[model samples]
Every structure is written in structure tokens, then in C-alpha cells.
Target: MLEDKNQEKTSLSELGEFGLIKHLTKHFSSYHKTTIKSVGDDAAVIDSSEKQTIVTTDLLIEGVHFDLSYMPLKHLGYKAVMVNLSDVYAMNAEAEQITVSIAISNRFPLEALEELYAGIQLACNTYNVDLIGGDTTSSTKGMLLSITAIGKANKEDVIYRSGAKPTDLVVVSGDLGGAYLGLQVLEREKQVFQVNPENQPDLDNYTYIIERQLKPEARKDIPELLKELDVKPTSMIDISDGLSSEIMHICTQSKTGCKLYEEKLPLDPQVISTCEEFEIDATMVALSGGEDYELLFTISIDDYDKIKGNPNLSVIGHITEENQGMNLVTRANQEIELKAQGWNSFKG
Candidate 1:
């Protein structure tokens, strides 16, 4: 009986493409009004109605973008969806559905894939988004995930990265650098385990930053908060590739300049302490440490009071004329050119 049970264990080849898709996606159900047809079809049917649709896709490679040694499959699943949805929210739209495609090597068993889907389901439930459809395939090497998020907004409410003007106030939601610092802690612990396999890591000190890396949440509330406050962002983006790179993107796309104050950059207390322990500059970490997933936006200076003292928002800088150039004003009053040093998946 044990031999028969072992033989009955299904492999990717045995299940084939259609069989695997049916088995895995059977538990998923649609929850969005726009998701007219989810799964079991040639394509996902979305009823956009009178609203404009916003779509964004992101691909994460195993070895290049994430190290599976430290990143659990479940967290990877949740983070994948969050990363794509962040882009949708950045456009000031509401994410309604997502299509998740994955390529996994034969080494992954059916149960392992189930664990990944569990996390995906958790995220979908938390954000109230529908799992419309996706593809599953075999990979020659490590696992890879590609997620495409679809959102909607009125034509007048849609925000773009190129809408910032001079004199606009620059704002960011939540503290920066926690995710990058979390990566550092994880890498260090991984090395320690490699050298001494018996040593159990004490991760209590790194809890916050570690969560920031492994299970970062997208800012799904910022857009809603802006709507409640009657404030429309002139420009916006999610801080996936570091604040410096994202700010540079906004400035370049808007054909404007910016002055970012070093002191005004938000940092969690844990991030600050971790930087001190690692002897790293917190300011630099906040500027170039990517994967924050917070929303960075620009608003009209006239509407500043609505968000001025809100704990969830931080006013970090202001837009400047194109001729002024992008500069960082240090605490000591030194002006320096800002550069983009965020995470580069293609970097060798």
C-alpha cells in the first residue's frame, strides 16, 4: 500500500497543463463586479463600464530577484501580488483583479505549490481583489512569478507620474529603508547559518525590518485617504526601487526639478536602530534602500493643510523649476546631486 501511494504522487508531466490549471484554480472565486469571467475561459472578461482601466505587470525571478533560501514560498506569493497592485494604487486607481502566472521547476511538489497558493488567497482576501486568471508552466531552473494587476478609476481621477509641476509638495506614505535593512539582516543570518549550522538565530531584534522585507504591504489606503481629504495628487509612484530612483522618475517624467531634504525623509525607529547597529548611514538607506512599497506623491501646495499633520503622511520635499536641477539638501545645508541606487534585478 505504501509503495502504491508513493507511486500515485503526481508530477507535473502526469498532470499536464490543463489538468494542473484546473486542480490549482478550482478553489479561487471571483469577488469583483468588473470580473465578469474569471478562469475557465479563453481570457478573463472584465466589464470596465464607464471607468478607465489601469493595468500593470511585474515579474520576479527566483535567483535574480529573490533568494528562496530565506524567502518562503508563501511570503513570495503574497509579495508578488502586492508589488503589482502597488503600481495600480500609485495611479490612484482601485485594484480589482489580478492574473498570477508562475513557472516552477519539477523539484517543487504539489504540496509546495499549494502552500504558495494559500498565501495568494490570503492576499486576495485581504485586499478584496479577485483572482481572475493566469498560467502555470515548467521552469528549467528556479521558480518565477509574473503578476498582472488590473484596476479602474474615473478619467478625471487618474494620476500619472508626469503630472507634477513646480511648487508642488512632495509627500511619502510610511517610513523608508525597513525593507532593505530587513534584507541585510536576513543575508547576515543566512551566512551565519552556513558557517555554523547548529546556531539558532535570535531574530527578535530584527522583527519589524524582517517583516518589512518578507511581507511588505502595498499602500492600498493612500488613494482612499486622498479622496476623503479632497486632495488630488498631481503625480505619484510606489517606492519599489528606492526613494531616490522613484523621485528621479517623477522629476524626469514631469520635466521638473526637486529639492529633497535629508532630515525630512521618514525612517522607522527600528530602521534607525538597525542602521546604527550595522554602522550604515540611515539617511542613505532611506534614500537608496528599495522595496519600501510606500506611496510617493506630489500635491498642490495650496492643499497642504489637509494632509499637513496626518501621521500616515510625510511631507519630504517640494518640486522645483527644471533649471534648478535635482538636489538633496543635507542637514548641514550642503547641496548634492541625487542619484538612483535602488535594487537592480539585472545587475551582475
Candidate 2:
């Protein structure tokens, strides 16, 4: 599926780097007034004002971060943007722009790159972000994408991971475990297809989870919702890594312990059912399932009333004194020490 001989393929060398950049980014329009200049310049410029500027970048290597066998190029482009935007949103800021740099192998056709940029354009249009300056080059192997998201917030509004205090409530937006299970399903289908090339995967039942893996949306609305509710998070981090790993980052930086209740961790119906079918522990899946792109943050105990009934938010736990240590209080009435077991790319 990666290579389509029947489809019209134009060699990337035909356009060259500069031509390719112009051709792909021709349709991208600047949505942010802060963007003074976009592509086709010495460097893109932004007229940032009084708001604090937040910048975050992520590098995605082909085989290390993604597998193209089951992942679509369009989804890859969109997911790459989401990967960076999530970080900006974690700071409780509004994402306004992104710069995408890519290094591609010769195997990719210009049309394939077009498909890739089409996804990026869709994300920019949907998220109201502008495409700034980026570099293009050849690669030795597969694709590598590095996206830098730029955002802004008022001086008093930016949140950090080190500001969580004792008794602050730990909150997460959206559910967990779907992206990991989605990857599991896609990997399983890939294996089956490798064994039997004619096999057609029936993924009707796995649509939600599969999309969760392939086309995750950054939590751009959470910051807005918090502001509307008149609540501000004391400490915040995006759930790119996993619930356990992210909370550990918050606690370790904030110098406080946490106790996440297993029963309180949000899980969608499909996630719960898929976990049962896979014969895997759902709790561990939620704890270590990376790439969910949800926002996890801590807020003062006094603000609980503001967010209590919000469907988009879940109060999973609360901060504790550092002496108590980070733990997961299980539904079985057991307390287990939490570890950073989620999404270690260097793991053997």
C-alpha cells in the first residue's frame, strides 16, 4: 500500500527543493495576524505583541516514531502537526503558527509529498495556524518531520509543570488507552496482510480507536474551556507520553506526590471493550499508552467546583506531600507505586 505503481508518480527531483516548497505551500493562507511573513523569505517573521510567546518543536523519525505500512501519509502529516501543537497547548496558550521541516528519501514522489502537505494544510486550516519557514532536504532512508509550534498567552496566563502544589486536583481532558490499542489493531492487521496479501482487514469495529492512533487532535480547546470556566491550572503537561509518565513529570517538577485513582481514569467505551478483547490490563494500557495527545494538569482544590460536571474534563487524582510518593490507588484497594513505564523510544 505504501507504493502505488498505477498512480501518477512525479519524481521529487523535478521540482527541486525550492520549487517543491512553493508548490506545496501555495494554498496555505495565513490565519494569524501575528504572522508578518510566511514561506519564500530569508526567514518567516511574526509580530508578537504583549502576550508571552511559547515555542515547541518535535522530531519524528520514520521507523522510530512511525511505521508507514499502515499509517497514511496524510494522517502522518496531520499527526506530526498535532505532536507539536499539543506541547504548546499544554502551556495553556493559543497556538498561532507552525514551521514544518522535512527530510525525505528519493523513494517518495512529488505527488506523495503533495499528499503529505495536503494533510498539513488541512490541519493548519482546521486549527487556524499559519505555515512559517522550514527547510527541505533529502534523507538516506525514510521520512523525518520536525514541526515547531508557536503560540501566545498573556503574561499572567502561561502555565508550567513546576507550579503544582499540594492538594491541587489532577485533571485530564478526554480519555486514554485508545491510541495504543489502535496501534495494536493496525499492527495486527499489518502482520495479517504480510502473511496473506489478499486479506482485507475489516476495521469497521475499530474506527474510533484507529483514528485515535492515526489522526489525533491536539487539545486546543481545553485552555479555552478553562478560561471560560474561570479556572486556571497550576501545572500542566500534554499526555504525549502516558498518564503515569506525564503525571510523574508534573510531580517531579512541582516537588509534590500524586495519587491517581484507577476508577477515575477516563476510558472510552471502545477502549474498554478493546482492552478486553486484547486480553491486556486496561489500567496499564491507560497508564502507558503514549500518543493520546490529551492535556493533563493540576488545579487548586478551590477550583474543583468550577470544572466538576464538565464532560470534557476528568478529575483523576490530587496532589500530595512529597513524602507520600507517587502512587496509583487501584480499584482493588491496593496502592502501587507509579513508574515512568510509558513510551520509551530507546527501550530495547
Provide the RMSD of all predictions against the true structure, rounded to 1 decimal: 11.2, 11.2
Cα-based lDDT at residue 304, candidate 2: 95
| Range of the 10 consecutive residues with the lowest summed lDDT in candidate 1 | 36-45
Alpha-carbon error at 41 in model 2, in Å? 30
lDDT against true structure, model 1 = 0.88
TM-score of 2: 0.86
User: How well is each residue in 1-348 modelled by candidate 2, as lDDT tens digits?
Assistant: 767576578766556544587899999999998765466421233556776677777889999899999889999999999988898888777888899999999999999899899999999999999999899999999999999888877767778788999999999999998999999999999999999999999999899999999999999999999999999999988988889988988898788999999999999999999999999999999999989999999999999999999999999999999999999999997999998777655444
> lDDT by residue for model 1 over 1-348, one digit each (tens)?
435456657656555444577799999888887765454321233557778677777889988789989998899899998998898888888899999999999999998899889889989999999999999999999899999998888767777788999999999999999999999999999999999999999999999999999999999999999999999999988998899988988898899999999999999999999999999999999999999999999999999999999999999999999999999999999999998877654344
Global lDDT of each candidate: 0.88, 0.88
TM-score of 1: 0.86
Clashing pairs in 1: none
Global lDDT for candidate 2? 0.88
